[model samples]
Target: MQPPTLSLIGTTPRMRWAWTAAGVLLIAGWVHRPASAQEPAIFRGADLKLGEELIAQHRCAQCHAEKVGGDGSAIYRPLGVINNAGLLRGMVEQCNATLNFQMFPEEVTAVAAVLNRDHYRFKD
Candidate 1:
């Protein structure tokens, strides 16, 4: 026997619209799911070793120690106002600018990411 015709499959505009909507939803989901997942997590793919090296070169911990006393870790208040990834990165960038560390953008990001991994741990 032959298969049902398009007229028989979707006799009504509502039925056709429903199928269209379902198709749209499916395609939209297929397109969007990967995009959302593809977005790199804060601190993802960071070079920890380079970050450490840069921190040492910049005397970041030393300055912090002088500023707050102790190993300088005390200067990084995990519970203080800088509680987000963007803020954390921004703080590092600001420090980079003010300190004139001349760190590249990626270096700054890597440094901030390492700091986040070690102390901040800001989850999206």
Candidate 2:
């Protein structure tokens, strides 16, 4: 009886180089992947500072506080009906319309991005 054996000794130099390159590429892809890749595409390149400023300037927290009480963060409802990134952004747009904020499309995306980063944390 003979025991089975595994060997890479037969592999050519080119084959070994190819395998090494593949491994390096795979590792690099995982390492360089953007953290925001999981977030909705609409959130990409959004101005977070502008969003925070708008949120404060518009007194969103103040209004929410008046409606839901406390710091007003309770209205977020991560598990509530306003689930998903698109819906969250849409809600912000709705607020903009209803409040007559007249914010530009990028402004809406900014606000939604800030909200997603802080409250909703929607992945996509």
| Number of the top-ranking candidate, with lDDT as the measure | 2
lDDT of 2: 0.88
Estimate, for each residue in 4-121, the C-alpha lDDT of model 1 and write its tens digit: 7876768588998998999999999898774324323766777888998898888899989988998888888778998777888889999999988889989998899778767777
Compute each candidate's TM-score over C-alphas.
0.65, 0.74
Q: Across residues 1-101, which tens digit of lDDT does each residue of candidate 2 receive?
A: 32333134225577778878999999999999986676777797899999999999999999999999999988889899888888999999999999999
Model 2 residue 31 CA deviation (Å) reads 3.5
Clashes of each: 0, 0
lDDT of each: 0.82, 0.88
Model 2 regions lying over 4 Å from their true place: 1-27, 34-37
